[model samples]
Target: MCRNWGGGPLLVVECESDVSFSGEENIGLYQSSQWAERGFCKQCGSHLFYKLKQNNQYFIPVGLFDNCEGLVFDHQVFIDEKPKYYCFANQTKNLTGAEVFAQFAPPE
Candidate 1:
């Protein structure tokens, strides 16, 4: 379970494979218009959460939270870009690239 500094929603993700990373390298994807902030476990280097900069919302990969209980997903973004190797069996709303950009685009 992952929580922000304010102790609000607990972000959860299940890990499909082990992820190892050095502390010095950046763990997230960011650009001029979009950002996908990521958090990792310091001890085991596990990917924790992916946060959106536009709405201050977050999404957990669900793979890292295998044992996590009672968590809900509001939606899923980048469904089209999702890797073909894996599939999420849940029935949450999946957002396309254009839909996500329109909704989360930076204000003019």
Candidate 2:
């Protein structure tokens, strides 16, 4: 996340289904990891979403939405990798990178 998202905490909305884009020509995809890819806007270089290679799951940055009325900051991932300079006051579920992989990684 840090390597792709300009080295900061990125708030993303995880979607279980495929996210449709109106301007497909402006979207650029980079294979960020073995299991996923990151999408960006080619015209403005704005980071779009991180998508799983194995599924339709997409982690779209919350900032892209026009209205954030119902969104909740209930959980966080890669807690161990978060920079020590910033902190959150919310009493939410947090998971380390290893814990995330353990819970979501497919059985081999």
Candidate 3:
């Protein structure tokens, strides 16, 4: 959510598993919404990840990685809420917020 990050879109890479941190104890978790939580560094307050409560899935910022030579720009979520002042040039599979919820929301 852009509003959460000082009115800027956060570019993130989604990971379902195999994510680890060096100083794991320093990361603080905040319940940002009913369905999601946000992780950040406790010391300097650097944004770490946005995690889904239902599945423990993590959406980590792309800038956090030391090596990003092989990453690809494939898909983007929450396309409908994108600000009019900016747009990405990548030809990505864009999904609106509702579409993302419909596809990933846990079963009742």
Please give the distance, in angstroms, between residue 12's alpha carbon in candidate 2 and its true position after superposition.
Answer: 0.6
All models, RMSD in angstroms: 10.4, 1.5, 1.5
TM per model?
0.46, 0.90, 0.89
Candidate 3 lDDT at 70 equals: 83
Deviation (Å) of 53 in candidate 3: 1.7
Give each model's whole-structure lDDT.
0.55, 0.84, 0.85
Instruction: Output candidate 1 Cα RMSD.
Output: 10.4
- The top-ranked prediction according to lDDT is 3
Better of 1 and 2 by TM-score: 2
Q: Which has the better TM-score: candidate 1, or candidate 3?
A: 3
**Model 1 weakest lDDT span, ten residues long:** 1-10
Task: Tell me the lDDT of candidate 3.
Answer: 0.85
The TM-score leader among the candidates is 2
Query: Clashing residue pairs in candidate 3, if any?
Result: none
Tens-place lDDT per residue, model 3, 20-68, is: 8889999999888787889999999999998888888888989988988
